[model samples]
Target: METILKIENLTKDFGRIRALNNVSFTIEKGNVYGILGPNGSGKSTTLGIILNVVNKTSGNFTWFDGKTSTHDALKKVGAIIERPNFYPYMTAQQNLELVCKIKGISKNIIDEKLEAVNLLEWKNYKFSSYSLGMKQRLAIASALLNDPEILILDEPTNGLDPQGIHEIRSIIKKIAKTGTTILLASHLLDEVEKVCSHAVIIRKGVMLYAGPVDEMSATNGIIEAKTEEISLEELAVALEKSPQISSANVDFDKVVAKLNTEVSATEINKFLISQGIVVSYFEKRLPSLEQQFLELTNNK
Candidate 1:
């Protein structure tokens, strides 16, 4: 995979406050990455430093594998670090034209960008007349005016109603489908879990975990089973006797067991059959991202 951005021991300080400390991660091409944490967890600070809007106190980051200057590299990147400003009276089309002029790009791509964000039909609508979701869609359209290779969004769905949030997420998924690398910083666990393929968890300027979202739930083993041929208590005792199972407990009408590494639901079933027992129900429980997120951040 082509590395788009590489950060080595990235650190930032705001006077006496250490906003970021030794944070390091790499973003590859054509992947959606989520920088996740609770509010005030240095997510925006990290994005700001990388975007060159704020200077890093210590450590280093290279864009495009250190192949180009920051100024040139940024030309291929589009970002929204804060609320985007636009003339309330200006039509969405006119506002994007202004962005084209400022960026010195041709206005020819204006329609294409608007359509990409599902705002082309509202091109002539005044910015002041549009709803908050429409305004956000226009902001996204403006970011794409340069036809950037990478898009950076800081809390893009923050403070939006459910419908508004759905619109933004749909637009993001659409953009990702076109193979644009996206770096999204958000505090919402559901947003990250649904939209991003990989995530990095940050807390109070500390990096807790970084990797694929699926791996977060894979560290723990949980299996839920139900039986009609045996009592729940009997099933639980039988499960605990298996070498692959660490512990088993009765929950309601079922037995829940925690398995050792490399253990599978099929293995548990085979063991039960060998013990002259048959299970009528079986399920492998995969922890949700919300569950893992709380466990990780709460521990710190």
Candidate 2:
């Protein structure tokens, strides 16, 4: 597949605080790639650097494999990096019309783009009168005014209710069906899990993992449980002594352990029970993306 964006040793430092740390990755065409991270994890900073809005402290990036002039290459991308400024008094059509004029595009595709976002019915509604969901859809429509090849959205569903989120997600998926590559930056793991085909996990401006979403969603050999007989600290020590376990920690009422193998849950239970620790309850559970994210971010 052709590469759409590539970053090499991307780094950014603000005084003594490093916002990005040698982060690197590639985005290929036709992938819904999620830049997954928590707040202040350099998600926005990476986007800003790539979009030429925020200056990077170091490193470099290329778009369209350097096939065209920088301006022309950038013209192939549309983005909603931050909150858009819409004229409250203007209707959705009017707002899009203005964007068209500023972008030197046609007024012809306004209705078509609004229709793609399911906003054609409300095309004449004033921006101030639209609901949050509708307003967000209009912003998406404005970004699509130029029909760019790739779309970049930063926290596209940031402050919406569940229904609003669902609506926006559906709209984005619908747009993706039209063959536009998408780069989504979000802290919502479930959203990324549902909407993206692949994801990059980042923490403290560092790339922790990057690959297929399914691969990232695979088991991390984590097991969470509580005991009735043994003290939490004792259970943790017992878990540490086991050859099948790699690391163990106590989180208040629960003791969590990372197993060395997938089938070692029974071994873990057996060892703890043999060590005079009661296994009150046990479950062989797979790690979730939320758990993976928490482990990656909290531990480091």
Candidate 3:
């Protein structure tokens, strides 16, 4: 895969506090890359630095393989760090027209971008009359005014209802289908798991995990099993005896075990039965992005 962006020991310091610390990662050309972390984990600061909205204290980053200058590289990327400022009295079309003029791009594409966000029908409506979701969609349309090759969205679905979130997510998917690499900063693990192919998890200005989302999940899988015939202590002993099992915890009536890739759920089940334990419930679960994320951050 071709590299779209590369961060080399990127560091950012604000007075005595470091917002980002030696964060390094590479995003490929066609990936929906997610920068994920809890609030105050430097997700926004990282994005801000990369977009040149917030200056980094040290280190550096490059875009488009550094084939172009920073200013030129920025032209290929459309970003929304937060809610965009639009004249409340201005119509959506008028707002987009202003964006086009500012970017020195043709205003003729205003309709196309608005249509992409499904805002074409209300293009004549004043920005003040639009709902929160509507305003967000308009902001997105404005970002697309230049037909950018890369899109950077910071919590695009933040502060919206489930339906509104669905709408925005659909629009993002539509954009990605056009082969635009997307860099998304979000704290919503479910959203990132659903929308992103790759993930970079950070906490307290430090990088925790960076890899394919599936690979992250596979690093530590969960296996849930229960057998009424076996005592909890006996089950724990059995799992501990097995090299495949790393750890097992008795959570209520079931034994929740964390397994390595070398161990299959089938092996677990078969081994227990060999000990005359009949499982009443057995299930193998791949760790979700949320599960892996929490374990990596482990703040609690």
C-alpha RMSD values across all candidates: 3.6, 4.0, 2.8
Name the top TM-score candidate. 3
Give the CA lDDT, 0 to 100, for residue 10 in model 3. Answer: 90
Winning model by lDDT: 1
Could you give candidate 1's per-residue lDDT for residues 152-243 as a string of tens digits? 99999877899989999988888888889999999888887787888899999999888887886556567888989878999999989998
What ranges in model 2 sit over 4 Å off?
Answer: 14-17, 102-104, 176-179, 216-259, 262-286
Preferred candidate (TM-score higher): 1 or 2: 1
lDDT of each: 0.86, 0.83, 0.85
TM-score of each: 0.82, 0.77, 0.88
Instruction: List the candidate 1 regions with Cα displacement exceeding 4 Å.
Output: 216-221, 224-242, 247-257, 269-281
lDDT for model 1 comes to 0.86
Cα RMSD (Å) between model 1 and the true structure?
A: 3.6
Q: What pairs collide in candidate 3?
A: none
Off by over 4 Å in 3: 217-220, 226-241, 250-255, 275-281
TM for candidate 3 is: 0.88
lDDT of 2: 0.83
